[model samples]
Target: MLHNKVEEVKSREDLIKFLLHLRKDLQTKGNAWENITLKDYLEAMEAWVEDMDGYYLNTNQPIPKQPSWKTIADILYAATMYE
Candidate 1:
């Protein structure tokens, strides 16, 4: 089930849609927001850094001097999901 959901994210647009769905799910389920803390916010930033590192290692691409706003938004959404 998880794999299928993951497989659906074939592009950045799909990912944004999925994250929006996840955000809605989290909201409807309740307490997801309540459970988040300052630490969680920091952890989300850490997750972004880790993700960037992994991307660099796996793709052999240098980090962009200026990451796109969409990329930053995606990272923040992912971090929130972790919380």
Candidate 2:
């Protein structure tokens, strides 16, 4: 399932996982962590679903903008589905 690779997102663990990834990226690339706040991830997830090609094909149908954390969780989850 796409959601499985998102790690244990219990009690905001999702956000923590995101932060840890951000930290690692910083340490490796020496670039400041991109501000992937909950709001930003929500927007990115909407974009990912509406367009981007991953394991699933999201319809081009338009959906209301929302800041649901699952929006991104689903995208990250879906990407690893086929891996």
Give all TM-scores, in the order shown.
0.42, 0.32
lDDT by candidate, in order shown = 0.57, 0.47
Count of backbone clashes, every candidate in sequence: 0, 0
Off by over 4 Å in 2: 1-11, 31-64, 71-83
lDDT of 2 by residue, 16-37 (tens): 6765664465457533323235
| Residue 83 in model 1: lDDT | 34
Off by over 4 Å in 1: 1-25, 29-35, 56-62, 81-83
* Model 2, CA-based lDDT: 0.47
Clashing residue pairs for model 2: none
